[model samples]
Target chain A: MTIHTKTLKQLSQGLQTGEYSSQELTQAYLNRIQQHSTLNSFITVTETQAIAAAKQADALLAAGNAPLLTGIPMAHKDIFCTQGIKTSCGSKMLDNFIAPYNATVVDKFNTAGMISLGKLNMDEFAMGSSNETSFYGSALNPWADSTVPGGSSGGSAAAVAARLIPAATGTDTGGSIRQPAAFCGITGLKPTYGRVSRYGMIAYASSLDQGGPMAQTAEDAALMLQAMAGFDAKDSTSAQQDVPDYSANLNDSLKGLKIGLPKEFFDEGLNSEMATTIETAINEYKKMGAEIVEVSMPHLKLAIPAYYVIAPAECSANLQRMDGVRFGHRCTDPEDLNDLYIRSRGEGFGTEVKRRILVGTYALSAGYYDAYYIKAQKIRRLISEDFAKALETVDVIMGPVTPTPAFGIGEKTADPIEMYLADIYTIAINLAGLPAMSVPAGFIDNKPVGLQIIGNYFAEAKLLNVAHQYQQVTNWHQQTPKGFE
Target chain B: MSLTTDDVNKIAYLARLGINTEDTESYTADLSNMLNLVAQMSSVDTDNVAPMAHPLDTIQRLRPDQVTESNQRDNFQAIAPQVEEGLYLVPKVLD
Candidate 1:
């Protein structure tokens, strides 16, 4: 039997009926990954572990007892720690380090019998909008080789979009997951701040980092989210809420659902093609009996400014653990204690990582603390309050995921401003700790553009419902890049 | 409100990052450009506004003060460039 856009449901039915076993499915993905290494979508493939897990999944199936995610293959962002796997957050600093334990999220997948494909590549320490900063190099836009797959979850989105694996995990620290999903034409979700566990996730920003699923469809994300989300005593931040059947109302029509379109997201500097695409998506929602209303987020423009401060400040503190003396890449020659510290860090980190560390250290400095770092945090509350107020008026918010479709690989690398601008449309959600998703809306210049749908806290079900309802009518998510096929 | 080359070097040093004094010129230029945008926050009157570092202000209910981390001292020090007994090795600080 051929694998043609198989969902978890289809794959499970096949595995249960003995049409194919977990090992066969794992091998198929391994073969695809080998064939598509040119895409640079994966940093390290956990072939040994994946095969071992597949064998276990097969045994469970034979025993007639299997979990919801049994034998379902998934990929993880490199930022997540996998026991004995090289869990580099796409930076050279930790390039040689192998985690001694699995992250809470990784253990969940393993316990559910989900076969691991490998660790997907990401931006250096989950920074940057394009995947270019990765030490392993950038993931190419499968849709258009000339462009980049948006990042820092670029590899996670690309692998799923390329069908190397049906779905993958991505951590969104200020839109890392959603932006890449938008560029790669897949469904990616950034659940609320505490919706998923972050323990053992090599965190760049403790407060903003959130892990969620990137898959071919909203229902697929829902199924993965079912396994991914819940309270974990291991993670202090993990919510104490029970995991809902995300697929329960996935078929629920969007009738009478109120969606707010923040005027700020559509104002000046918005791309015309992107605007048309989002307008088309919003129009489709209207036809589905959803109400669209204009909303104002006064703090919208403040998000980028606030995020640059808070994310980097937190990143600066989190990365302090990697001093080279503590099991990471070390420099060749060092005179003394000071030399060791300097050379180890300077050589270990990438340009972007250093940049953030510098910025973060600056913000948190004593003299400048109140002037910059503390001020940004005050603005953060306002940003979340803006989302809270908007939610009072609408069930969900819809807008463009990014200002444009996937850009050329090296197009904005030289200009940091251009790179940061791509995330302008998505960063505020992280500040608000709101759940958001990027669904393929349509194409602009033959590259996919995603319609961003954001929901209030704990609104994962509604976002998935809306995305699922939209996917039933539109085939944008179904289209694949030609040459990859 | 903008930072100078001296400011960049000072911040880098304070952050415990060793920087080549010569490279500070270029680092200064790039940092100045980036920091200039960030300087906007200075204009906002946050004098009385309480700093909100996290989305939710709940004091983290950390799992009891017990040591949750495993005793991976041996495993952790396995790949250390320099290790002695249970401690990570570093050069002598004082002469």
Candidate 2:
């Protein structure tokens, strides 16, 4: 049996039943990664490390003491710092940077006995919506070579969608995980802001950044998230709440489940074809005993503006540590301190990253601080309130993950505004610090569309239950790319 | 609503990012487009709404001051471009 085709749950059972040794399974996935190198999904493949870890897992299985995730070869978004691995946040600035420590999320996964195949590619500093901004070249969508795999977490989504790996870790500062998952037609979750520890997961926007699981199935996502979530002392913003077993409620029935369809989500900017696809998926939910209600979030339109400001402002501050003196790329010849700083950052960062840093600096500058930064903060409050008020009336919010399915790679790159608009539907949930996910709904023009599920703060399990229940009735999540299959 | 070339240069200088002279025109235009997008925030009336700094609206959790980390200066500085005596070397700040 091909190990790549098995879901995380099925793989766990297979390991437990001696169907395949973890070493063989790990080798199978490594071989597939070699076979699909043209996808550009992986930036660094840890072949030696993965094989050694797989051997350890095989020994554990021989002792009948294997963890659920033992020997499961997976890829991590390059944003997560892996000890002794090159952790390029898809920017030339970090192309030479080797992380000295593992991100807390990486530590958690490693502790659970999951073997990492390597680091996946992403948008530079998790700044862009399309994978095109990656310094390592765009991660091509497995479905269509010309189209983009939605980014910041684009590589993670693409790898999972193409069945290169069963699951991968992704961070969502603003719809990075969910949007890419939508574009790739996979299951991706963005947990409540503090649900997952952000320590060593290189900060894009400290307040908005969150790490979650990207997998082919919601049930697989549930298993992966169970290991990734929880508080850590390393991350000061980490919540003090207990993480619920995400898989516990996966089989829960959707009977009497209340799903809110945000009228704003279906309004202008949503593609007509995507709307029809989302509606069809909602009807399936309706058939599964879910009640759909219309909810209004008037300030939702302002989310993009507020996010563009606040996220960059935080990013400008967070990325300041990358000065030429410390670990990261540095200019070869610098006339002075300012020249070193300027040239290093200029050469290291990509166009999108520099654009953001410039905008962020301008917003937080002496003259524009109140007019831009403070004003945007207030808009953020209004946006969060819109979500809070809506959640009070509904159990969860449902919407289209993107205006359209994965567009051609170079289509939106020329217009930054148009590119930013691609995340319009997914950004508000980030501003509100709510849990949300993208699950495969249906295909439009042979390109997959995702149904976005937005849940209240810490409502991750509920969102997974909704997606898992839906996945049971539909085969959308199982449709792999033509060539990859 | 739009940033002039001078404004773009000043922002880049403050951000410590050097832009090729030829790219300045595009940067000026792109930054202006982003600013125009952010200009949407000004139209909303946020009179009573307080500026939110954090999502949870919680105070910073204070921990007792103590040394919690072991010395990894050598390991940490191993990746630095230039390090001497455990100190990162940058162009001199003071003449």
Candidate 3:
């Protein structure tokens, strides 16, 4: 197979053995990205910058002092600021905004000499579940042209799944990374909230936003997460805990692993076929000497209502920086200061963004604060408590990543509530600040189903261990989309 | 829980986002739908539960009162839409 089809680890090995130079590998992926332009996976293609970075990697490799990611080419979701690159966060508001500095994640990857292809597209400010909310056109699922690659990390999922790049960086707030990873038949990890720094990653919901890895396999994700996970002094919320070597425990046996299946995740709204696919994957775990326990997260149904209130409220606060001022889009010839602020924001933000800001503003408004904002926060506590209780008895929780496989583009746009329900299975994990992953399980009507594996806080190594073991026995993750190959 | 157009108008004004006259109806409908969806929170009793402002509930880490960054006003102001003499230009706030 060509270099573009190789796993990230395989590419690293290839570079080490002199099979291809970093420049050659970078060129190969850039060519594939050009070939698959119709997928709209990238918001910016840094060909000139990528070539220079790859040359630098080649120099390090020549000296036999290259780091693990020395020559690997990857894409970052548009949310992470790359110094001097347009970090739009998939919104028109920052369309002209060239990042003045690098996000902590970008700095880490650059320090390891990783070559970035460019910024990948995403939901506007990472708000939508379906990427349909992106100001840049929605990224298409490589599995089916008409279907959406899930968002707010849609482009990251699409590019990685289509093999335009071996892997990409993605941020998950409410199932953005995992859902798209499921729809696109790839592996995605949403690390525990504070595990990754949020310094220059454009904020969506401050408490829920987290950056992680999306790749073709659990091993690749583990490798990427190794570099991405660490505390930065710049991010006030960064955890002070020591970073663990994610790849160190990937080969651990799954025998005696206690997996919890939340009843609410498999209840009424789940598609029957999708549930069956998840069941088969669970049975595979059972055959591997793992024990499955049924657990109840009774307040999981409250997650959506709570998340809708809390996320928007935080989003409204977080996105207030985009008003026409020092930076970002400015409306033409404003009559006054108020006119400038209102018109610039109104014109800059998309429909879903506006709707969210409005909802958030209303929720946090004086008279409604106790009724809506505080109530949602109380419900958030209950949801987190439920996960905390369930996780005490089981090593990990297993569920469907999304309620169904990929839905067609434009299907749920008119009804925002229907679209919000797509994230039902995944949102509670975010609310609880737990680490979770989505791995390819099987297919439904030719679309891939994702088996979501959620672990307790700081349990990324265990999650990767479980997923790596499952991937060793099943070929689901290795399956590539037809035309993309 | 249904929000009227007037309510939406007030909310938009509070948010400082201008809604075009033509799009007001749709914006009102969309905002109302979202509010209705979130209205379920009020039905659940949360009398004694403490409001969670953050996930980990970690307090902000305070650093020593020392300067960590050097002045880069020129570099920072370079990206501003309108700037003059290292100062960001904005609409007149007072006479």
Candidate 4:
């Protein structure tokens, strides 16, 4: 098998057995990344740093006490701050901003002896559903050249799907990771809020943003999460709860697992073919002794409207720090401080980002605060309650990740609302702050579909176990795109 | 409710974002469409529901008033768009 096609586990074993040196592995990935540069999956390629780190990892391996991820190649979403690297988050505002310190997640990965290839591309400030909002340009779906790979984790998903890198980190706010992972035909987990530290991940919406792993399989995702999931004193909102070993239950039997099917998820907006694809995947679970339960989450419909308000409102507050004076972009010949703030931000951000910021400003402004922001928060509570009530009756929830397969590049760009609707099936989980994953289920019109499996708070292990079992029964997750294979 | 160009301009001002005159019309339409989407929230009555600020609704953990991080002013200011002599330089506020 080609080195690029090897799963994280197989690569770890290869390293242990001296089948291939870390330097050789890192070089292979770097070569693939350069060869597939048309995918636009990376913003920065740290050839020197990756090789240097791999050499260090080789020394550790020779000493005989390295972690499973040691010497294994991976990339981080540009959203995470990597000290001395340009952590742009796919925005012109930070195009010149090199991080002064590592984000907690980056520090953790480095500590695990993982060699980072470089920074992956993402939507500007993690705003758009399609990665077209990225200042670095859109990352093409490896499945098809004309379609989007999904965003703000678009680069991360595309890179992993193309096997340019084994895995990459992605942050989700309103289904960024899972949606992109679905579109790209990979396994991605968005852990329950606070499960991963967000100290150095560029803040989009502080309350909703979460960092997680995107890989080719549930087992690989579990391995990445094992290194990523932990509490950090730096992120105040990070959960103090101990993280369970995600790999412990990967092979666990799915017998008697109760999977909830939310009635709202199969509404008229759902693509009929996509529905059939998800049904087939669920049928496979049923054959494995899992039971399907029909549940109602009426409030699921409000997730997008509520998310649009809360996420933007939090983002407006979080992003206020990007003014010209201290860091990020600055306008030349500014007349005054206000001019610097206005013109700098105007020159820095993209259209979608500006739209969200304006919407947030309006929602929080006088007279509209109660009418918009507060109302959305209250609806958020209802959405969370819906999940809480449903989880009481089922071990996990299953549904289609996106309404349809990957849309063409410019398909939904003109209509922001249409793009927002793409995330309808997945946003409720973030509102409820629950752990969820997207596992490749089947294909439609030559593109892939994902079966979203959502679990209660801090149930990442259970989600991984369920997904891993499904992967074992089927080869959907193992299928590579046409040219990539 | 739909936002007018006037409303969009006001919002852009409040956000400290300079919206070009040419883009204001589009921004108005887009922001209005988004607000219309957000208008759906009014259909649900959350009269007794408490606002959820955090997903888990957990209170923030307060750390003791101790300096955990050493000063890295130089390291941080190195990326500043305009900085000199350990101070971030901006237009004079009191001239």
**Decoy 3 TM-score against native:** 0.99
| Tens-digit lDDT track of model 1 for B20-73 | 778777777767767776766665566667777666666777666677677778
User: Model 4: runs farther than 4 Å from truth?
Assistant: none
lDDT digits (tens) for residues B1-95 of candidate 2: 87789989988999998899999999999989988888888788998989887888877788899999999999999999999998989887898
Question: For candidate 2 chain A, which ten residues in a row score worst on lDDT?
Answer: A1-10
Fraction of real interface contacts that model 4 preserves: 0.93
Question: What TM-score goes with each of the models?
Answer: 0.97, 0.99, 0.99, 0.99
Error of 1 at A443 (Å): 0.4
RMSD of each: 1.5, 0.9, 0.9, 0.7
lDDT of 1 by residue, A91-168 (tens): 998899888788999988888789988999899999988899999999988898789898899999889888899999
Winner by lDDT = 4
**Residue A284 lDDT in model 3?**
96
Note the residue pairs that clash in candidate 4: none
Cα-based lDDT for every prediction: 0.87, 0.91, 0.92, 0.94
Give the top-scoring candidate (DockQ). Answer: 4
Q: Is the docking of candidate 2 incorrect, acceptable, medium or high quality?
A: high
For residues A1-485, could you state the per-residue lDDT of candidate 2 as single tens digits? 56687899999898888898888998899899999999999999999999999999888888988889887878899999999999999999999999999999999998899999999999999999988999999999998989999999999999999999999999998899999999999999999999999999999999899999999888988889899999899989999899888889888888898889889999878889999999999999999998988999998888998988998888999889889888898998898999999999989998999889988998899988998889988998998988898889888899999999999989998999999988999998888888999999999999999999999899999999999999999999999999988
Q: Which stretches of model 2 miss by more than 4 angstroms?
A: none
Query: Residue A210 lDDT in model 4?
Result: 98
